[model samples]
Target: MANNQRIQLKGRVFITFNIKAVTGLHIGGTESGIEIGGVDKTVIRDPLTNRPYIPGSSLKGKMRSLLEKYKGLRQNQRIGQGYIHSCDNPEEYPNCEVCQVFGVPGERDFATPTRLVVRDVMMTDKSAQDLEVSGRTDLPYTEVKTEVSIDRVTSAANPRQMERVPAGTEFGPAELVYSLYDGDGCDVQKDIEHLRTLVEGLQLLEDDYLGGLGSRGSGKVKLENITVALRVGETYAEEKKLLDKFENLGCLVEKLKELQDQIRQHVGK
Candidate 1:
């Protein structure tokens, strides 16, 4: 009889945060989203309507907020600088780098948002009726690697500065439109501010280079897709699920734009 050694998986999870800036003239800044708070706050804007859409900056900002919670940092202030060199300190340490370089200190330049791709790895081991650690131990296990990529507008080659979309040619499905909410004039104005914040966070990265450290300036980020992957016992079920979810979300976004069009038609905005 053979005793089966339970296969344990251990590996690094390369969770990538693909940050990018906002592009597309029709959709850039003000004209896109709605106002929520004091000013107009933007959420993800519809692509086909020349309206507001959530920028990658918002996603990264939200992630940074979440990370702060995990690290028990102050809520009021922004996180450390990103992976860039703004001051001379980084040149000296060569180790303890600053955060702002990666768009931490102040709102990163609209031109470029410093994206610092960070990763953490963990391993696991199992023993077949054996134990070894400080004294003595041995273990057997299977390693599984997984990663999730949250890609934002990280690409360059600004489309915002491009010539206007041909008049009356029908903006493609990629064009975004703004949806007007049912409310008084002031109410509508408020939502606009909220929508803008989300829009400002968008940063584009190059496409040629996706993750690796060196690829930082190689390519740019585009609004084409957000891919995530996972591995489980030689089967990457999570990755498949994530991709499907991404597709579904994209579809829903399109639907939202259609709804916005209806609003524009009825209200005559």
Candidate 2:
């Protein structure tokens, strides 16, 4: 019966925030076509604007990876060249927060709608303008950082240049859209809980790092100026702000019950 059921969209919660680069952030992109003296590693950028931006896939993947590790979930599913944790058992799909929020393989018999959508974050106009005219940036709105590695056997030093968005730069307003659903043995409760998991993932990301070169000190980020709104069921046409501008995820964490209460008040109708 569960396998034959259909899922229905109940609502969506919108989370918007700013990503402040506390340290030089590096999310590598192709190093092709650079001059001999150019950076060997480069941050990913929007093709149209040539401004380095955070890809949704990068953030979402990082969150999922962190959550999986936190939950001690098994990494059994192979995705491209990497392996990610996925609960293959349909029976367990509804119960696993990672799978419920991130989703499972399409071929799975119990495949249900994934509840989360993370959007690519772009630079704020102010940041873009500041970096553009600052004259300190090596490239457009970015800086080149050179790093060195010591060869163990040869006892030699090899230096490589990496492109990064300079510290104190901000990219936003970052957005995450979370969908609530019904049917298929799932209810709004599960979706609501998944929302909690979603927020937790973001919290995990802040403590961890974003992009590459994290271990050696890069990709440190903070989520700030967060606002959460919702559009639910009968009132789907109208967007209501559950939580007004909060400073960070920690603030939201303290108010989860209130957030849930606000959601319940709206949806219980």
Considering every candidate listed, which one attains the maximal lDDT?
2
The 10 consecutive residues of candidate 1 with the worst lDDT sum are 137-146
Q: What is the per-residue lDDT of model 2 for residues 1-269, given as tens digits with 9 covering 90 to 100?
A: 23567877777888999999999999888877888878898888999998889999999999999999999999998989999999888667767999888877777777787778899999888999999889999888888888899999998999988889999999999999988888765688767766788888989999999999999899999999999988887778775656556898899988887887777676662
> Tens-digit lDDT track for model 1 on 120-141?
2111122211222233211111
After superposition on all C-alphas, the RMSD of every candidate to the true structure, in Å, is 25.6, 1.7
- Candidate 2 residue pairs in backbone clash: none
Task: Give stretches of model 2 more than 4 Å off.
Answer: 1-4, 240-242
Q: Residue 150 deviation, candidate 1, in Å?
A: 39
* Per-candidate local distance difference test: 0.27, 0.86
TM-score of 1: 0.21
Question: CA shift at 173, candidate 1, in angstroms?
Answer: 14
TM-score of 2: 0.95
- Which parts of model 1 are misplaced by more than 4 Å? 1-52, 74-101, 105-113, 116-269
